[model samples]
Target: MKTTLVLAMTADGKIADVTKSPPTFGSDRDYAHMVEQILLADVVLVGSGTLLDGNESSEVREPDRALIQARIDRGQTPQPPQIICSRSGKIDPQLPFFSQPIERWLLTTKKGSLDWIERASFGRVLVCETADGSDIDWQAVKVKLAELGVENICFLGGSELAASLFAADFIDELWLTICPFIYGGSAAPSPVSGVGFTSDLAPRLRLLSVDRVEQELFLHYQVEKKSEDIPPT
Candidate 1:
């Protein structure tokens, strides 16, 4: 699938402040841009933590009516399916997203407990695991998503999941909005957080476009492979 990471970061590349909560630094235009990108995707992904952090819904909001109509004009669904990735499948069943009309799927490992089985009524529970006891194998996840006809995936969530997708080279595009603010601290969270790549093996981005709305700058980049390449997913 063509995967895109959509997020807004501060001037210092922090997605969250020292408090470790999702920052609210971007403007309405940035949010509208994100909704537009979401409308173009076949599936939307969010980490469990990100989902529970707020009462976010997978359904397209009224403000995004034009973007939703754009998708409908192209023969796409009004709202793309939303998938929640939780290695252990421990998300709260009462989360607002579960009550929305949008299709929801839980992509998790077999190691997940049956404690959340009762919540399966809310959405399809896909238990994927590997013999090595590692996290839900992303390769299997991709194949399964493909079987479900997911051609484009919009990743909108916390940095940990974003880091895994980047490390696996599963992300194709990055639509970043850089807000004109600085939340500098050692604990500030970046858009991609995990054991990152070394300088020699870092992923390179080819700038596709740049747009400015007041102080915020929207950057669209296509992930590119360099000489010292990271293998594909």
Candidate 2:
């Protein structure tokens, strides 16, 4: 029932260069490490922006590697579930991922998206009511994931969703790939889109490990609230 956020960023502190593209700006070794984590997860979650692949967000291919094969060896059929958070259900209908009846979960707050959810009912889409009793309480999304038997969740993060999960105090760990250069200007997006929202205020992180691939640095932090560890700035 633990949530882990996995992301790759640049040393300039940019998750996306300037276009919000992903699985990019990483070294070969870093990519290998990412595969290892994906293989160990019980569910892979991403943002709708990521799958959309517009001029704002770039395309990312499905990860296929030895870890998936190992999952099969361990009797984990198919693969870990794929969870996408789309407020508008604007995801591409033509995505090849929809071609199969795989276990894919979508989280949305729109009542109109119900039809889209039904259209994708071949998969599972949850139309959730908000926390104020008015809209979707996305903070409960992972709670639902846990109830559905998810043990490990790898959030292939961009920024917005990661910020939300952080605010929700659901993220237990973080895998950040820090590159060697800065690209974005004053207008560029910050690595994490969090602002004004902090559940475990002054949150703390325990550096689980670190790896250096060429000039890039991979920082893995175990998220511990102030009760568990000293909070950071």
**Candidate topping TM-score:** 1
Candidate 1, residue 12: Cα displacement in angstroms equals 0.5
lDDT of 1 by residue, 1-233 (tens): 79999999999999888998757898999888888888889889989878877666556788778888899999888898888888887777676777787888787877674666675534677776677755877778788888878899999978899888887778889999999999999898888888988986778887889999999999999997444443464
List clash counts for every candidate, in order: 0, 4
Show the colliding residue pairs in model 1.
none
Which pairs clash in model 2? 11-179, 129-135, 130-135, 130-136
Candidate 2 structure lDDT: 0.68
True-vs-predicted CA distance for residue 122, candidate 1, Å:
4.1
lDDT at position 52, candidate 2: 62
Per-model lDDT: 0.82, 0.68
Query: Over the stretch 70-118, how does candidate 2's per-residue lDDT look in tens digits?
Result: 8888777446667777766666766766654457777776662665754
Evaluate residue 181 in candidate 2 and report its C-alpha lDDT on the 0 to 100 scale: 69
TM-score of each: 0.90, 0.82
On lDDT, the leading prediction is: 1
